[model samples]
Target: MNRKIYISLAILCVLVLSLQAACFARTPDKLPNVKILATGGTIAGSGATNTTTVGYTAAVTPVDALINNVPELKKIANVSGEQISQIASENMTNEVWLKLAKQVNTLLSQDDVDGIVITHGTDTLEETAYFLNLVVKSEKPVVVVGSMRPPTAMSADGMLNLYRATILAGSREAAGKGVLVMLNDTIHAGRDVTKTITDRVDTFRAPEIGPLGFFTGDKPVFYRAPLRKHTVFTEFDISQLTDLPRVDIVYHYANNTGDVIKALTQAGVKGIVHAGTGNGSIGKVEYPAVEAAQEKGVVIVRSARVGNGIVARNGEANDDKYNFVAGDNLNPQKARILLMLALTKTSNPEDIQRMFWEY
Candidate 1:
C-alpha cells in the first residue's frame, strides 16, 4: 500500500510538470501581434554625426531597419513592419492621412493583428494623431511615436520610444482609450496632446488634461482616460474618401486686416479655422472679412491661439449670431482636422458645433 501511494504522488507531480511545459511552449503563440506602420519622422532619421541631433535627414531609414535595431521588441510581441510613407511629418499630407487611416482600419479588422504603432515626425505629429483619433474604427490600441533626436545621435531615443509604443499597442489596458501619442516614456491622448517645445524629447503634452499614463519599464500604468468621444465612438468615416475638403487657418493679430481670410474665401476653401487672439476673440478689423467669408457659405470655426483653455461658443465671439462653430479645446491645427472631417458629414453650423462638443 505504501509503494502504491508513493507511485501515485510521483505520477501527479509528473503530470503537473508536463502541463507547465506545455504552457511555456505556447507562450510565444499567445503573445500579442503588433503591427508597426512607419511614416517618416525623426525616429527614422539619420544624422551626419553621432553628436549631431539636429539637421538630420528624416525618413532615410527603412521600416525593417527600425524593427531589426530593436530586438527587445520581439520578446514583448509578435512584431512586423510596413512602410506607409517615407516623408517627414511636416510634409504629411491629407492624402497620406487618408491612406494611413484606411490601412489602420484594415489591419485592426483582421483577427491576427491585435494593435498598431505608427512612427511619425513630431512636427504635425499631433495633427496626424488627432486625425487618426477621429477616424480609426477600432477599439484596439493605436500609438503614434516620434523622436526629437535622430537615430544616429549619441542618445538616440527612437529605439526606446519604439519599444514602449509597441508595448502599449499590445497592452489590453490601452484599448478603447483613443489614439495615444507616446514619447519620453509618457503616454498622451492624441486629441489633447500638442508639441509644446520645438526641439525637446519631452515636447508633447496635454496641457489641460495631462497624460493618460506612463510606461513603467515594460508595463503601462494608467492614471485616467480621456472623457472625450473618440475612435469607435466618433462619427467621422474615411473609408470611401479619396480626399478631404480644403481647409485653411487664419491667424489673428493686432491691426490685422482679414486679407488672408478673404484670399482663402476667394480660393474657395470649404472651411477656415480662425486662430483668435484670446478667448477666440476676433479683432474689430478682422471681423468683417470673417463675416464676409461666412456670408459666402464658408464654414468658420473660432479656435484659440493660446494653447490652453477652451474656445467656448458665444463667450468672446457670438458663434450663434454668425452661425460659426467654436473649436472647444482643440487648437487651430486640430480644429482644422475636425472641420475638414465635419464638413464631410454636414454643412450646418449647429451640427458641426455638436461634433465639436462631443468629439
Candidate 2:
C-alpha cells in the first residue's frame, strides 16, 4: 500500500522519541533554583481594606507582585524576582544593609544559584536576619522571609509566608542552616529570631531557643542544630565592606541618665549597645553616662531589655572593670548587628568578647 504506509510512519516515530526521553527523564529533579530578593516587608504590604491590617502601605507590592501572588511558588523553586527595596521595614538601612549584603554575596557566587529568599520587613526582620547570620559567605539556603499580615490583610499571611519561603529556599535540608527565619510554619535561627507579636501572624519567636524546625506538611522538619559559628565559618568579611561602624542602641530606662550614652559618644559612635536592666544591668543612673562613654573610646555592648535570656558574661556587670561586652543572647536590635560587624573586625573587648561569644 505504499510500503505499508512507511512501516506505520516508522513505528510512530519510535513511540514519539521514547515518550520524549521519559518526559525528559522525569521533570521533577530540576527544581532548586530560588532567588527572590525583594525587600518591602509585611511581605510587600498594601491595604485599602481587605479588612485593613493596621494602617497599611509598606513596600507597596512589586517584586513581580510578590512573585505573582505565589502561584504555589511554581511547585517549589526555579523562581526569580529582584526589586531590592521599597522601604518601611522601619526604613531598614545601613544602606540597605550594604545593599543586601552585596546582593547576597553576588547571588551566592552562582553556578546556577540554588538558594536565598529574603523578603524582609517584620520590622528589621531580626536585624536583617542577624546581618545575614554574620555576613553570608554562603552555605547555600539563606531564607529570611516576613509577614505580620498586610498582603492586603484579612487572613492574608503573605501567601503562606511566600510559600514557606520557597520551601525553605529549595531545601537540601536547608544546607548548612544558618541564616533562616521563615515565618509561622516556623524555622527561625537567623541567630535567634525575634519579633514577638505586634500585628500577629504568629509574630516570629525564638526566645530561649524554640525553633529550628517546623513546616510539617511541606516537609522541612529539623530539630535543633544551630551551634553558632555561621556560614563558611564566618569572620565577617563583607568583601571589602564599604562602611558600617557607627553602632548605637542606648535604652536602659527608669530615670536612666546614660544621656544616650553621652549622646552616642558625642555623635561619633564607634559602638554602644546598652539596652540594659536585668542581667545586662546598667541603670544606677546609667552608670556614669556609661562611664563617660567608656572613657571616650566607646565600645560598651551590654544588651538586655529583658526579652529572653543570656546577657551573662560577668554577673553584676563589672565586665572586667568596665571594658563591657555582654550582649550574649543578642537583642538590642541584635546588639546593633553584632556591634556593627564587630567594629569592622576587632576593637578588642576581649576580642569583642570572643565576637559576642562566637557569633
Candidate 3:
C-alpha cells in the first residue's frame, strides 16, 4: 500500500470514531430529553409473588423494566427514570408531595427538558396531580400515571400505564392543560379525576367531566379540556405544598355529637372538613364547634360522607350560617385538596370559597 494512502486511512478512522461519539452524545441541547420522575405508585410497584391481586408497594417497581417491556417507546422519545420514593399512596405526606413538586419544578426550569412524567400511586394521585396542576409553572407536558395491578400480578397493568403516560408527556396536545392523569389509556385532567372502582383495572373515572382524551399507540388525542383554575397553570403558586396543612375531617353519624370536630380542632388542626350525613347537613350540636373553628380561622369545607352526591347549598342556612363552603360533589379528601390549594392563595373565606367554586 502507498504510504500516503496509509495516512489517509488513519485520518478516516479518527473521523469515524469522532462521529460515533457525537451521535451518541447525551446532552439535552443535542438530544431530545424528557424527565421521568418516579414516585412510588402501582405502576412502579412490586408485590409479593404470592399476592398477585393488585395490592403492591408503590415505587418499589421500576420504570426501567416497564420501559424495557415496552420497547416501542424508543420510537417516541428518550426516557430517563428517576425514583423519587417508594411508598404506598396512603402513606404519602406533604413532604413527599413537595419533593415531587420540586423535581418537576427543576425539570421545567431546565431548557433541555421538553416535558415531565410522574409515576404515582393511584390512591392519592388525584390530589397530588391536582396540586401540580395548580402549581408547576410550565406549559410543557406534565403527566402523572399509576397502575391498578402490581408488577407480579397475573397480568400487571403498570407497563401500559407508564407507556401511555410517557407518550402523553411528550405530546403537544397535553401541554398548557396543566398536570394530567393518564391511566387505563384514558387521559384525565388531574382536577376532575376520581377513582370510581374499588378493584378493577378500568378505575379512575371522571363522571362529571369526560376524559381529556385517550393515548393511541405512541400518540395522545385530546377530546376535552378541564374547566378549572388548577395549580401550576393557575395565577398563583402552591409551593405551600411543603407545609403540612393540619386539616381534619369528621363523618356525621345518627345523633352525631360535635366532639370529633371540637377534639380535632383542640388537637391543633388548621382546617376541617365536615362529612355531613345528608346533603352536607350538620347535626344540630355539631354547628357550634365548627363555628368556633371558623371564628378561630380554621378553614372549613362542607362535604358529603355518603360516598357519592353533591353538597348543594341553600342560602347557607345550615352550613353558611357557620361560614363553610359547599364541597359540591367532592368528598372529604378532595375538599381538603381544594382547601389546601386555596389556602396558598388567600386565607379569606370568601376567596377560598370562590376558589373552590371556580376550581
TM-score, cand. 3 vs. native: 0.84
Tens digits of per-residue lDDT for model 3, 57-98? 556656567567777667667888787887778788888877
Q: Please report, in order, the local distance difference test score of every candidate based on alpha carbons.
A: 0.93, 0.84, 0.77
What's the TM for model 2?
A: 0.35
Sorting all predicted structures by lDDT, with the top scorer first, yields: 1, 2, 3
Q: Pick the candidate with the highest TM-score.
A: 1
Number of the top lDDT candidate? 1
The reply for model 3, stretches above 4 Å from the true place, is 1-32, 54-58, 62-66, 239-241, 307-310, 315-320
Collision pairs in model 1: none
What lDDT tens digits, residue by residue, belong to model 1 across residues 1-359? 99999999999999999999886552778889999999999999999999988788988999999999999988889999999999988899999999999999999999999999999999999999999999999999999999999999998999999999999999889999999999999999999999999888888999978999898878899999989999999989899999999999998888888899989999999899999988999888887888888888899999989999999889998788889899999999999999999999988999999999998
- Which stretches of model 2 miss by more than 4 angstroms? 1-26, 33-51, 55-69, 76-121, 135-138, 152-157, 160-230, 235-249, 252-272, 275-299, 302-332, 336-348, 353-359
What is the descending TM-score order?
1, 3, 2
**lDDT of candidate 3 vs native?**
0.77
TM-score of each: 0.93, 0.35, 0.84
- Give the per-residue Cα lDDT of candidate 1 at 58: 89
